[model samples]
Target: MAYFSKHYHNPGTEPGTLVAKSDLGRPVTIHLIDYTEDHLEEVRLANAADCREYLERESKTWIQVNGQADPETLRNLGDLFDLHDLALEDVLNTGQRPKLELYDDQLFIIAAMPFYNGDKLDIVQISLFIGKNYLICLCPLDEDPFEPVRKRMRLANNRRFVTRDIDYLLYALLDLVTDSGFPVLEQFGYQLEEMETDLLENPNQRTLARIHGLKRELLVLRRVLWPQRELLTGLMRTEDPLIHANTQVYFRDCHDHSVQIIELLESFREMATSMLDIYLSSISQRTNETMRVLTIIATIFIPLTFVAGVYGMNFQNPDSPWAMPELGWYFGYPMAWGVMIAIAAGLLWFFKRRGWM
Candidate 1:
């Protein structure tokens, strides 16, 4: 994942100019699903223009475009569906902040879908165009996150799921995208617990690095999720006809989920920051402990070194009798050893009594 969208045109480029990403080498695939109360048809098409006939039918049409499309394909989709030029441009340029824009007679929405690709977090931008009888979804990635919704639609015996309107379908898709973060959040939660344990017990540089990485990921999640809450609010409050009153209720639920995810991200950020502080404090504390032990050892040797220095300065002549009387004695060597040991033991005892040991 990049810090920003890698797709952009030159400074003087005109508005609504569609530029396909140079790195987008995969071929675009279109999946068409037409359904009603009791009728259903699903097929894959080789071209975006093939959706024209399906759009004319009485049943609802769902055109799922998977992969980054070229300029020609985007133009074909725009001309066929009467999509706004600006909306098409945004679709071509990925990594848009989540938002809802109203075109002449269509409602356009941009949402970010986050998932874990191995140990890395990646986000895909999904652009949706909601029409009276159709919902066109443009997914930047090839994986289908809407498989669960399709499975629900295919269950003929599911009585509780009776809404056949495209608005309901739109709600389902948004809800899926919003809730996809839960699993990712769960993974983060486990990592946090492990890091917290390490931080409290035996923190190291690796633990601090993990905390920083988590904070960065949480920041990215916040960027993706904060606008989604506002987008959901706009959808519920706006009097867009494409989103029916009944569907607004579902959107409200999805908005609640977005808020929940944001709250989780906020808490995780705080925890990461706290873990960093804990790691620093632990390191400082260990350093202080080591310094104290070294200082005590140096303090204990100070008097012992002074005594050894005095005895080493020897004068064996009678003229130096006043300075070297003990050096010539028979027990002088043992006496010096005893004096050094006594001084060292005394200092240790004093330190223990003063609670500095």
Candidate 2:
């Protein structure tokens, strides 16, 4: 997977400054959904200024901005919604840690949404501005993950969306963001299981590399998921009237999901560590087996070498009694071969009986 680079202004730049970034080349696309219990109107806007007329309506409104917008568009949106300058800057500069900020006019939330792009994990920064009768979402990525929520709102018979206020909508979005990590975690689960199998059968350098790679991915997942639990807790504990009591219950469920994700990450990390240990043990065991076999072969050949050395000294003096008599025997060459074979056979039997083979 490719790494995600953080985008930020210069160190001395103003907090509210909205700088145009070259990395963000996608044109901004704005989609508006305004609805009541029995009415719904969906439209695509060419300019952020067009949202002013819908914001003035009595019905609840949801504005979704996909990709990066120009400075003029961002300023127009900030003026229309009274968005804090610092919050706008954050929206412009992505890669922010998930957090919750209580602004004077709205409840601001920053969340990381995780998804897989063809077997690789990718995260997009999603910023939400929750007002009394409206919800604004800004996503820096091109993919839109909120289509399911939009589809549900279009259904006429679904009371969950029909009977709820903007707060419930905010909860829905939060719940989606919290649960997005499951699929990514599921992919990790499959990879870890395969690694475990390979570790058991026969581990090599590639197995070790796979283990290290998985550990790094898990670390990234943990960084993205750990703060989310606290973010959800902050949302639930806030006394702001923006979030309803009934909707807080849903937020609690979302918090539980975050805790579950974190626990899974910890379990995966432990498994990755243990897999590395298993790989090392396998390599050590193979080396020991090889050394034992080599030692046995050398031990068997030692006595054979001594016999050959004694017979090779051709001291065949007829006057000396102990001058290597085997050298003078008629069957001297065959006799030497028989002696070496016997010695090898005896050694093999001894080793087998001693359970050292």
Candidate 3:
């Protein structure tokens, strides 16, 4: 896994070097939100350069790009902002854990957005470059999952992203990232119920494997998410002028989000462990039933085998009184069969009354 971790950077020898992950899909799609306290403009840019004019001026600008497909365009954006080399590298490296770094003049944040609303567990990597007056976010996917945040920005009275300091924009984005996890956890809860159903109705090795796989995915998510608690904690406690004093309260909310996520994860782990126990208990119950039936059958057969053995013994003649004289009786076979049936019936009735049949 060091290989994957090193994919974030090629060690700490240089500040701004290009070690972009080779597997990045393509150059990103660009969207722009140029807003002031009173006005807002949302548009899809044909080029990432279209926002340069707004960035040059003194208005709140947001140039959000989805996915990191084109390395050249990312490099160019880094150049346009005079981004620190390390910050540029962070933009291209898609696998880093959630982090917050205050570089030369920018607050570069790389965080994973957890999404489980859909079929699979989705984690979108979002790298934000927050400058003095502009905010540029590089999303790891082509789709925009921040429409709710965007909708909030459009409201006339609550255009906080436009009127507030760059820190508020960062908070909104991180809030979006952390908020997404709660829904994913909800979806996981649903899937876990499905797992339990399959376990109860008809347990199988395949179901067990799925349970293990899902637990492992949750574990991986836990590894990525718990550190974000510290990240938010650090941001809230720092005295950085870039982050306004009032912003700590918002960061506290984000910290609470992380706590909720951690608690949910712990709950899921406990449920999974309980599920395993339920599975084992079911198997033990089934095995015990089978053994009881077998023991009852053997008990019923023991006396019958003894009676047959006595009749099977060979004895020489009329002088041997211990011999089975019933063999010469007029209706010996019918009498023996009637006796056997009566014994069997009596044993069956006794077992039935005992609730062991």
- Displacement of the residue 193 alpha carbon in candidate 3, Å: 2.5
Local accuracy of candidate 1 as per-residue lDDT tens digits, 286-354: 999999999999998888889999887876677753768887799999999999999888988998999
Which model is ahead, 2 or 3, in terms of TM-score? 2
User: Of the candidates shown, which would achieve the greatest lDDT relative to the real structure?
Assistant: 2
Worst 10 residues of 1 by lDDT: 157-166
lDDT by residue (tens digit), candidate 2, 85-142: 9988888888888999997759999999888888677788899999989999988766
Candidate 2 wrongly placed segments (more than 4 Å): 1-4
Model-by-model lDDT, in order?
0.87, 0.88, 0.79
Model 1 lDDT vs. the true structure? 0.87
Q: If both were scored by lDDT, which would come out higher, candidate 2 or candidate 3?
A: 2
What shift in Å separates residue 131 of candidate 2 from its native position after superposition? 0.9
Regarding TM-score, does 1 or 2 come out ahead? Answer: 1
Tens digit of per-residue lDDT, candidate 3, span 1-357 = 122342555556576667656677765788888888878888888776666778776777888888764667777787788777676776676667788887767777778877754566666678888888888888877778777888888887785677688788789889988888888888789879999998889877888887887777788788789878878887889777778888889999998988999899889988988887888888788889999989988888888888788777755377787776888888977887788788888999999998887
